[model samples]
Target: MRWIAILPVLALAACAAPEAPGSERVPAARAIERPFDVSTNVDFILVDKSDRTLTLFRKGTPVRAYRGVAFGDAPTGHKRFQGDERTPEGRYRIEYGNPQSAFHLSLKISYPNAEDRAYAAKHGLSPGGDIFIHGQPNGSPEGQKIASHWTDGCIALSDAEIEELWQTVPDGTPIEIRP
Candidate 1:
């Protein structure tokens, strides 16, 4: 009888817990709109290594700028392997999007291109992949506001950011991750 009271507490925790491995995580119940709409093709992409900013543009002016967490350790070049936490510095594309992503939502950034793969192979290593601009792990949207660097080998954004980017960004958009 004493343990029966604890069941409700456990049930609430379960509902608030992060998504489990191989589990599908979706956006929040209240859907939000995007700040700006970006087209699929871009004239060019710019990344300021000094500042942790991912900017999108059509021609010369900035259409949108997102505050992002770059590689924890000075994002210099392509990630050689796992645990590096280095956001690749290169020209890539948003190959796809995931509505059922573990991080709530994501815009896939194409990392480990042919040259990247070849470089990793030449050095006898695995060019880290699955690097994306995604939302926080689990439902910890608030936790991300306090994070200073990377841990999941991908660029992380606040939950609100993920939703904003998800709506504004289109598939096949060019992305440039800089150091």
Candidate 2:
């Protein structure tokens, strides 16, 4: 009985060992790099909750903004369960981008932070991970354009918008999402 639990632990340890130096090892070194280094030093972030939008600014100027499509059905406050279909409301950063995503383009979001994990643990459920800001799926671009609330919990942008974002937003840029 106890041996069964040990097997998974060993498997997890074996998998985790190789990823130590990828990013988590150093806090500042792995920060995301946005494409646009605005002429002005960006100071704050802007999230248009109602419109499901997120913007990056430099020195009070809008360097770039993304008109994303948010969670579909009854998207609410912070994400709680595995399939809540709600975009989380909090302070987070862009960790990375996925060039081979199902979506035309994709950027990884830092979800399931300490607070999120803790909340899920307390509630005896999953906080639902793998949230990201990405483009429409390969064949669903048209469908996405025609509808709102699509992704599981990530912010999505139009093909053109994602291209702009890809060039303007760096990996380490800070992002804030609000309701």
* TM-scores of all candidate predictions against the true structure: 0.68, 0.69
Clashing pairs in 1: 49-179
Candidate 1 local lDDT, 49-157, one digit each (tens): 4576656566555656655444445466557675677777777888888877787687788887998889888989888788787877667646455357654457776
RMSD of each: 17.5, 16.4
Best by TM-score: 2
Residue 83, model 1, lDDT: 62
Lowest lDDT sum, 10 consecutive residues, model 1, at: 23-32
Q: What is the TM-score of candidate 2?
A: 0.69
Write candidate 2's Cα lDDT for 140-169 as tens digits: 746456357767777777776676667666
Q: Candidate 2 regions off by >4 Å?
A: 1-45, 66-68, 141-144
Please give the lDDT score for candidate 2.
Answer: 0.67
- Once fitted onto the true fold, the runs of candidate 1 whose alpha carbons sit more than 4 angstroms away are 1-45, 68-76, 141-144
